[model samples]
Target: MQIYEGKTAFRGIAEGKIKVYRKDQQQIKREHAENTQEELLRFERAKGEALRQLTGLYEKALKEVGEANAAIFEVHQMMLEDPDYVESITNMIRTQKVNAAYAVASTGDNFSQMFSMMEDDYMRERAADIRDISERLVGILAGRTGSQMELTEPVILVADDLAPSETVQLDKDKVLAFVTVHGSSNSHTAILARTMNIPALFRVNIPLDDTVDGKEGIVDGYHGRIYLEPEPRVREELEARQAEERRKQELLWQLKGKENVTLDGRRIEIYANIGSFGDVAAVLQNDAGGIGLFRSEFLYLESEDYPSEEEQFQVYKKVAESMAGRKVIIRTLDIGADKQVGYFQMEPEENPALGYRAIRICLDRPEIFKTQLRAIYRASAYGTVSIMYPMIISVEEVDRIAEIVGEVQEELKQQQIPFGDVEQGIMIETPAAALISDLLAKKVDFFSIGTNDLVQYTLASDRQNPKLEQICDPHHPAILRLIRLIADNAHREGIWVGICGELGADLTLTETFLNMGIDELSVSPGLVLSVRKKVRETKLGEKYN
Candidate 1:
């Protein structure tokens, strides 16, 4: 028996035969074609076929996953049709006097390498997308089908890594779990696996030899362990753990529709944070009270250029309408730092975290900011929609945002476009914002403390630095006191305060937050019921009052 340890992306248990996925990079010969015209024609035909396949994949994904995820296929289709990408392949073929496949392979290598070397995480993932699309075109030109894994039976899939396209195209029923030798928790594969509720382990050091193929394996996603040829006793224990998890999930479903109130009769709202429209389904499935944080940056990150007002409006409207009458607090474009956009034309900085980002970028580039404000206001007419600005460190920033919003409203009115009265708010992330919470609270409808940045800035510890992990404690006395101070200041001004960061999802802090009079706790959809359950079981002590 062989045992391997790794990091878990999702918690579940599954035992099945292991199937090692091997995507062999095809080598294209540098053969000169008789006619350059013929090579260009072949490339066009292959490109058209790739587009057709991508469109079909888009529809399939839309049905299987939600729109936000299915949007990847649309992105893939756009990439395949990108004029620059097409020009690169064609120019290579004509200039180099090589076959169409050779041109595609060479261009793919260059583009993929460039993307992989980018500083941003989102842009780095695009490297995989470029490779996926290039492989499709190359396959078509070479008279062979693209890389598709066919499963004859259910098995645990093990791979070095999986591209977003490849991960989405898997036969879900036949793939019980995913084990990748190299991948990050933020990778597309991890995101899709969590969305699909599939067990996954990444960063595992496993033998890559084909000799391990078809071997019986047990995956314990909860503990991040893989057991190969498990002993009878270990197998039984795993079965029991799986059964227990199933029971717990069933029990959680029973908590749905129940108010998130403590035994002491104090009610707190449990909401979900969503990145895109696709995440709305999970929010509803988990019975969250409302969306506390609707990250508007995904639209910006996914687009090749600035997303149009109409495009942003339609998406915002869909999210609002889908939530019924529940409130949706959409945070305006929090880009830069770890999340960077190519067209934003931002300069490289030694410390991007503290540099031009979020509201700073929006305020400097009012044209871009105003377009988004118009979209939010227009969507508000469909249902309740509120706007929140990120990285606000002063009352003046809030004042500036309010001014732009007023401009957008006036323009919409003159155009005879209808909109609703949307509430405005700011994130309390920096120490400066929290310190002057009383003054800032009076300027906005509510306060949502973004602890992810709050903790990092407070302790002067980089959140991404593993060595400083201990100093980045969310439950530290200083952090808790800041939360208390913000809550108190906001309450004094008749404004509610909520935590919408990783700390909000921490079960250990649920009661403490309730005692602190936190109006709401916003976490991922998967943690809604669990947090609600914790709220329902707790009784506020006299010390809290």
Candidate 2:
């Protein structure tokens, strides 16, 4: 009977049998030369079936299904075309002459072996993805499930872990909510659940075998709690809370069409921090001002090939056109250890966040940096494009970045490329970035404080690590002071400062940022209306002291 509280992202209380998926699937038998031809036959059949199932997901009827429910479909598509995966399996089958199942098994074990040696947790976790996809292929070859799990009644998926592919195969209309023993906030499965607006919780770290077998219990995704055999009083309280949540959500929807003007006639802008075109549509639907954080991570994810200048330009152009006249602040290719671009070879590090990430990577690879800058500058002609650099620790970084940007601009001009004037900026994530605001202010056009990482680094806590997660507070006094310094410095220099982080959505900090001279707040699409409502309620000259 333990209770935990967190911001309610989704409202629902469901009770169901916990179907756990704990098997890594990577520890399987390898194929030998005697059965190689048979394994190749099996591999081709599985590959073809994988393609067919993927095709079915796109067949208009299935296309409209929830993204969380359609993830396996996408993963299967990747398996069908992934040369690295397919070739490895094919080469093993041809060279070793092993049985079909043994060949797939061998390939899975090889991938798992390789991934386990890698340092990145995310990449290591991807080994599970490989196993999951390979097992699905094996299942398809055996006529077992074919990515379809017969979830008859509403059930909470209780698992030690759930992969993005497994979560995608969930029956969305029937799924009440999901509870997992292990997963982070940024895990693809958790992200997909959020995207589908499903009530899902992770990092439970509890055995669901006895607690959730057949007994009636409440799985509260909002609070990340499980009430096993709850009393009537608890049920009543939950029902009341659910009702209140519904009312609040209705109010948020009603505020969407309304203006976000502050008391005393001041107008404040509310924008959405989006990562892709799909996100742009969501922002537009929510009536956001424009895109604030058009993270270029999606481009890196979509292709193994380094997105050429023209390829990058077209993507940026599409986002710009979608925004129409609204400002689209495009953050230049923010890449590093955390977000590894497969094509680039990077040295492994003990600490990825403090390691070669963002501007640090760009500085080392000037040609790569120049290519992205050139693409951004070229895209500026199509719409309002602002070039932003991530993780700037000193003014020297900004100066070097600006120098590279100028070089790119001159090169583009020499080639007679039509590009517009793009504003340059830096993300105030590090304490150093915020502390030296005056120096950076002189070198950049503006600042967008990424408070998520800022709070983590400022507090000396790893936000992703469960052990130190409790100390990663955005509300800490030091973080607030740094944010204030950044905002004040930008304002004094006649440049605007905006926050593109979870802090922007925090009602308690909204007025604090405004009082500190912050110009704008960029949050998720679902939060825009509520934050806008809060902004309208704020008064001028409200002292934080």
Each model's lDDT comes to 0.89, 0.74
Which ranges in model 1 have alpha carbons more than 4 Å from their true place? 74-95, 114-123, 342-351, 411-418, 459-472, 476-478, 542-545
Q: Model 1 reaches what TM-score against the true structure?
A: 0.90
CA RMSD of all predictions: 2.9, 4.3
Model 1 has an lDDT value of 0.89
Residues 1-545 of candidate 1 have per-residue lDDT tens digits of: 88999989888999999999988768889989789999999999998888888888877776777665666777787778778888998998888888999999999999999988976556677888898899888888878874478888999999988877788788899999999998767776787888898999998999877667889999999899999888999999999999998898899999998998899898998999998898898999999999999999989877878999999999999999999989999999999988777678899887888999999999999999999999999999999998999999988898988888889999999999999988888899999999999999899999999999999999898776645778888888889999999999999999989999999989888888888889999999999999998999999974343
Candidate 2 C-alpha error for residue 179, in Å: 2.1
User: Would you estimate the TM-scores of all the predictions?
Assistant: 0.90, 0.84
The stretch of ten residues in a row with the least summed lDDT in candidate 1 is: 62-71
Each candidate: how many clashes?
0, 7
Q: Once superposed on the true structure, which residue ranges of model 2 sit more than 4 Å away at CA? A: 1-33, 44-120, 152-155, 204-217, 228-232, 264-266, 411-417, 540-545
Clashing pairs in 1: none
